[model samples]
Target: MSSRSTYHHGDLRQAVLSAALDVIATEGPSALSLRDLARRAGVSHAAPAHHFKDRAGLLTAVATEGFDLLAAALAQAKDLKDAGVRYVRFATEHPAHFQVMFQPDLHRPDDPELLAAKERAGAGLRAGIAGVPADGRGPDARLAGVAAWSLAHGFATLLLSHNLAGPIGEQDPEEVFRTLAGLLFTSDTAQPPQE
Candidate 1:
């Protein structure tokens, strides 16, 4: 049987998405092409376009999937620190997704599904920091959430870029993130931050 006949109806979309992820993981998002993904998935060149419309549509789907995955990961965390570590873990684990999810220019920023997924991920991130008490002179809950996100994102980017290999020296990325979180966010759970 031909490879094109292997994919059932819905399977082709996922196969294409998976192929896109593989390409992004190996060569970065710039390497992704609908034609290339279709070839990788063993489907006709028009198959991917049918599902994704074009490259931006394909990337938008990838970003949406990434956010959904991130939201799920964040939802599993026990606390802010755990969430931060999980965020880093998600980035390292889904480097291609991570790379595309943040680059609005690469995907259709106005896409409804993408916007919703982004909100879900943002809500998950905010919920992670919701219980933490703000230092009297520190930021409000909103700012605290932003700070937490920045810290995790920066660390993840460094790790993905291999910039942490020297300073971290093979130390577990998650553990390093946990330690970093501890240093930054006090264990004491005083009153939660003001809105």
Candidate 2:
């Protein structure tokens, strides 16, 4: 009969989170307010607080969800290059989650669930790097992993901000990333500079 009555009979927590995602996607995370989310979800203002406690709590949940999703996407990759492509795709698809995820100040950094999700994402990236064939020099896997992540994350950020639209006109982002990954991960390029 009424908005409040309808929300009360439905999934208020998910409704609030969905509304919050919409706000973050449209206006950025700084614009997210529990009151606004509650209004959007047609629930009592206090209903969101019952699930999230505060803005930081809600953002922590969003970050956790983002990391979990990223981990799942990475886990499905056939190889290191594919993992980089998947990372870019995940960022583009989940801009709201991506925005809140890396900004530690926007969410509760010490949250256990958030930490676990972050670890899972990190492990997936590391596993992808480990799958790469060694080139006799035995380059540090940790540095290689960081390189892969930086390439994907930087490319995704640039694409999301529309900075690559000119140079990459009409070219598919995933194909570009695959080529970039192939070049960087090759034996010659991956080696340390000779002294």
Candidate 3:
């Protein structure tokens, strides 16, 4: 006597995940709940537990899913110079995942699925950075990655926070992302650290 969607029981896991993301998208991570997700997905209240042990388990799955999708997006960029834009695009497009992926306290970071997805995402970014001709090595590469990540993360965070929506207009987020990327590449001039 289950009330799960009859369209395709096979996609139930993905359906729940999708619904979870939708929930996160509107209410932020702290607001996510398995019961609500089940209701959103048109499934019996018990449905999500089959794929996720509990609410924490579901959030963990969402973070893992987010990392995997981020890996896919980074992989699609195909160039280091495109990394920032790709990063921003992923963040804006996958706000729910982006929101939870960085919150280490919300989900178990050592979860096998999360670890594996993290590595895949790291590899994708590494590959993307490799395309940068002047990209350096060691700490330089690490710093470069941090810088690019910061730029994209900062931009996407702003977008998610609704701070940038005012000025961005119709200029595709990519365009602003690209412009910022250009800013990153344009000059190395710096004054000094503030005391």
Candidate 4:
């Protein structure tokens, strides 16, 4: 098939991307295919190949888009606590994107757009760490930052996977996260338990 797009529909590229996301959300990423996406987007079978060389290229594009969205979420945070909450929110809101973004084997990590977006997201995470006040007694900022991220990411992962509902009891995930954030912000060294 020619590299040129065969789609005459409006925003065919975006439509395909949206369809890919829908498929990922419903059937998981393993079931995604260019022909399937084309059918979902109401485009020719070769149209997706024109926009994306293959499945990996399409996944790379999705990962890049995901990182851009994550960066935006982190940038909107008011402080470290807010950043943690936002991180969980982003993961929960974009489960399909979050899944593909972390699975490097599924996409081309060296792609220019992917690299830039990853850098932007990393910068946003680091900026949130920078906003926290330096603690006395030789607190390691890098360690603290990692710990903060681990807590939020772990919690979000558990919530998404339905592993937290039992422990969460009557409290929602966001409420539990808010309490956890308060503790982290108030303590000099706060780390969630490993289970």
Candidate 5:
């Protein structure tokens, strides 16, 4: 059977999503269009429109799926450091999804499915943060969670953008991320800088 016929058999929505991801990976999100996705999926131009309604709808679906995937990855992490490494791996492996997941302006932020998936991802990250001990145990824990997330997210973004390629050289990104995560989350006996 032809590709279009295959889409008719089943999984058209997933096919369209996969096509959109390929397009985004190759040409970036700005280049994404429902019509183009339909063409890539070998479906009638109206087929994708029926499922997604518009570009924003398609992006919302992508964002939701992205967050779900991120939550699963984060959930597998044994601790904050492992979570950091997993976050980087997820971003690198799913660059298109990772890009859409962060740029809220591109999708319907109020979509129920999107919000739920976002919450799951947040909870997973928070769980990782909870593994770390803090003195205050209330406000300090919250602050530590935010800092841990920021560090991981920033590191992943920079690594994917090639900002770390020069300084990192051939060293493993996982090891590097683990080291950074440890320094930030774990206690160290280093002396403080003073004037």
Candidate 6:
């Protein structure tokens, strides 16, 4: 279904974003347009322009929504054995947003909403890292974030790129993710408290 919008509608922004997502899902990033989104939303073409100056603004909104959702999902799995697995789940479940988020050239990260969303996503990831045992001020700390982000990002990227579908072998994605997370979560040395 297309989106619906009304200035007074509580969910107008969400409706617009959702409709944009559907459009992106079927048409891919290149086809996104504020006018098209407005059409889908059954709102005036100029209406979206107000919320999103152009395509970048629209994409920024999508990315912000995605980051916010990702942060929430990762936070929910806080007590789970591995937050990285939650990260993978977040990426898989929100492929469209995840797709828009990383492709900076496709969306303007400087957009206020986009920046806030990016910070939230980064904070969520750092929180996940913080839950894990690690310490240091330089290379080691950087490694923790990179390792966790890379592992999750790599898994999500590979899955989306369809490069790991068969090589992953006889296991469901979640099972595989959990198993991988366990291995990755294991530090080379004993767990160290965050500094």
Worst 10 residues of 4 by lDDT: 184-193
Q: Cα lDDT of model 5 overall?
A: 0.87
On TM-score, the stronger of 3 and 6 is 3
Residues 49-163, candidate 5: write the lDDT tens digits.
7888999999999999999999999999998888888999999899999989999899999999999999999999888877776555344767878888898889889988899
lDDT of each: 0.90, 0.89, 0.80, 0.86, 0.87, 0.75
Candidate 4: residue pairs that collide: none
lDDT of 3 by residue, 83-177 (tens): 77788888888889999999989898889989999999998888765654452333466677777777878888998898887799777888888
Better of 2 and 5 by TM-score: 2
At residue 141, candidate 6 shows an lDDT of 53
TM-score between model 1 and native: 0.91
TM-score of 6: 0.81
Residue-level lDDT of model 2, residues 74-132, one tens digit each, is: 99988898899999999999999999999999999999999999999998898888777
Q: Would you list the clashing residue pairs of candidate 6?
A: none
User: What TM-score number comes out for model 2?
Assistant: 0.91
Worst 10 residues of 2 by lDDT: 1-10
Evaluate model 3: give its lDDT: 0.80
Weakest 10 consecutive residues, lDDT, candidate 1?
A: 1-10
Q: How many residue pairs clash in each candidate?
A: 0, 0, 0, 0, 0, 0
Ranking by lDDT: 1, 2, 5, 4, 3, 6
Off by over 4 Å in 5: 1-9, 137-139, 187-195
Badly placed stretches (over 4 Å) of model 2 are 1-9, 136-138, 187-195
Choose 5 or 6, whichever is better by TM-score: 5
Worst 10 residues of 5 by lDDT: 184-193
